[model samples]
Structure formats: C-alpha cells, structure tokens
Target: MSDTESNSSNRQTGIATALQHPQPFEESTIFDEYREIMTRSHEQQRQIYSEFKAFTDDVASWVKAASQFDNFRSRKRIKTRLEWIKAKHGEIEGVRREVVTCVEAVRAALSMLGGITRSLKGFSGIVKDEFDGGNDSDLQEPRSVDCAGPNQACAK
Candidate 1:
C-alpha cells in the first residue's frame, strides 16, 4: 500500500477506536452557571417581595391611624378627608396586587426554564446512545460521486 493509503487507514482505525469508547459526559459549567444565576434571581425576587410587603403594611397602618383623626375635625371636613384617604388607599392596594402578580409570573417562568433544562439533558443521552451504536463507519472515509456532465457541481 502507498504511504497516503496507509496513513488514511491508521486514522480511520483511530477514529473507530475512539468512537467505541466514548468519554462520559460531565456536568457542563454552563448548567452550573445558569443554576447559580437563577438562584440569585430568586433571592432578589424574595427580597423585593419582602420589602414591598413591608412598605404596603406600613401604608395600611398609616391609613388606619389617620382614621382616628375624625374626632378632631368638623364632620364635613372629616368626610372630605376620609374620601381622599380612601382613594389613595385604593391606589396603593392596586399597586400591591400588581407587584404580587409580577412576582408570581417570575416564579412560573423560572419553573418552566428548569423543566426545559431537564428535558434537554435527557435528550442528550438519547443522542449519545444513537452515536454509540456502531454507526462510526460513516466517519471512516469520504464517498466519491460522479459529476461528469455539463452543469454538474462537485461537492466536497
């Protein structure tokens, strides 16, 4: 055999051997990094939820305390003040509800991402198994095709 043919055969043998004993997949750093980022995001969300809850509680308490001032003011003045306070309280409650909704949405999205990551990991194993099932002959050598006619293209 010629030197080039001998070298090609050796290379193919090496590839076949390598394919027969594939390396085990290690946990990717990207997975760990994303997991860490998600954890930090969850922590931040919790902190924001706690702070918002505290602020809303304080607003509710202040509104309750202000209700006591009705005794000091004239009946007409007290009625007007109470109406304004009630409007403000309603606005605050609306904002509080929106915050809670936003937090819940974030949690749901994180759960979805976690599920997708797990599914991808499972799919990777199936792909690895398919490759390991003695399908390495295609990697041994390139196939030749005739392109003799006019307008024919030779693909590498």
Candidate 2:
C-alpha cells in the first residue's frame, strides 16, 4: 500500500477505513496494545533474567565455599571419596559455565525488547517522514523526561 493510503483514511473509497491521519507521537490502540504487551513482556523477562542472575551468583558462591572446604579438609585414606569430590567439582564448574551462558542469552533477549521499541517508534517516524522527506536528524534527537517539567517524553 502507498504511504498515503497506509497513513490516512481513504474517505472516498467507501470501505471501512483502517488508517487514521498520522501525527507525531499520535497513539493507536493497536500500537498501544502492542507497546503494553511488549513492555509487560520485557518487564517479566527482566525479572526472570534477574532471578537467573541471582541463582547463578548463589551457585558461584556455593562453588567458592565448596572449594574452600576442599582446601582445608585434611587428606585421608578415602581415595574413592576424594576422587568423587574432584569429579563433582569439575561438574559444578561445567554447570556454572552453562548458567553464565544462560544469563547472557536472557540479557540479549531483554536487549531485543528495546530494539523492538526502537523499530516500532521508527516505523511511526518513517510514516511521518514521508510528508516532509527532509533531513532526519530530528528523528535522532534525544527526548528527555524531566518529572518536574510539564512535558515528560522519553528521548529516542
């Protein structure tokens, strides 16, 4: 569909018009629903990610404590048990590495939420840009939200 058609209602077309006249930062229920969902999903993911990080950190501390115990424990004639402890230590290290990888992946997933927001905001901006079709430097401008001020907008 043409930008014009996509951006505005085709009043003369006699079909139920889906488009509304585009305005800067104008809200849409569809976009609002999406933004709400994305925002909630992002927050949920962040909480999960935080919990995972805390779990990993706790595991790391446990591993450290275990190592300390192994260091101070007196050597005895229980060769089999000692070997088992050594093997378990290696297993713990492997699990720790896996947890770290998982944490990193979750962080990346969370970061993509921000990317999605940017893309949606850009999609809206691009639609607006069609009318002016001039330098898009303003599109790059950072918006600030000073709570004390009358205007509170998040910068792009």
Candidate 3:
C-alpha cells in the first residue's frame, strides 16, 4: 500500500478502537462492569485536579519569588528570566484549563449517575408507597455549590 493509504488505514483503525471502547455510561444491572470504569475515571480526574492545584500553588510561589527580583541585572539575563517566568505561568494556565475540562467531564458523568440513581429511587419509591401507602421524601432539595471564591463551599 502507498504511504497515504497506510496512514489512512492506521487512522481508521484508531477510530475503530476509540469507538469500541468509548467512555462508560451508567448501567442498570446491580453488578455493572462499567461502574468500575466510572470509578477509575473519577479517581483519575481527582488526581488531575490535585496535580493542577499543586501546579497553581507552585506558580504562586514562583510569582512571589519573581516579585523579589527587583534588582537591576544584565538585559540578556533579565529577558531570559522574564521569558522563563512567562512560560511557567503559561504552563500553569494550560494545566488549569485541562483541570477545568476534566472536572466538567467528571461532573457530567456524576450528573448522569445522579439521574439514574434518582430514577431507581423513584421506582423503589413507587413500590414502597404502594405496599405501605406512605408518602416518600426521597426527593429532597438540591444542594447548591458556592463557586464564588477559591474555596467552593456547598450551601446547605
């Protein structure tokens, strides 16, 4: 096969593999295999968040150190330091963006899980309510998160 055709074939294979193993959605079975996958994803996402936070903390420290470098120096060294500092800041910013994206994806999965859980609860509620004819309070008010400042405290 020609180089182009070979590349195309490789791309097709990659696409096929990606579609074959797409991210897991919530399953109905009690022993859902995908639950483990979801849990792993959650853990991986949390790790990314932790790493991003550490990167941000390091950037904060670097910025504090840079602020102390007010003494006049050679133009070359000054330019090099400025460039290095900017690059570090940019790297931290990129990680922050990745963290946001990863967090949002994990949050979306959690939301889907929440929906499935609620549906299951509703079904169980109907069955329980039928047997005892009792009112159900499983559906409570949604908790609100305060994402205003650095610390996100969930409002009760």
lDDT winner among the candidates?
1
How much is the lDDT of residue 150 in candidate 2?
38
lDDT by residue (tens digit), candidate 2, 27-146: 687799999999999999999999999999999999999988886664543676889999999999999999778766765675553322222231123211111213555544433322
Clashing residue pairs, candidate 3?
A: none
Report the alpha-carbon TM-score of model 2 versus the true structure. Answer: 0.31
Q: Estimate each model's TM-score.
A: 0.30, 0.31, 0.28
Q: Which pairs in model 1 have colliding backbones?
A: none
Q: Model 3 — TM-score against the truth?
A: 0.28
| TM-score leaderboard ranking | 2, 1, 3
**C-alpha lDDT values of all predictions:** 0.68, 0.62, 0.65
Against the true structure, candidate 2 has what lDDT?
0.62
27-86: candidate 1 lDDT, tens digit per residue: 887799989999999999999999999999999998887886665467778789999999
- Where model 2 places Cα greater than 4 Å from the true spot, the runs are 1-27, 75-156
- How much is 151 displaced in model 2, in angstroms? 99
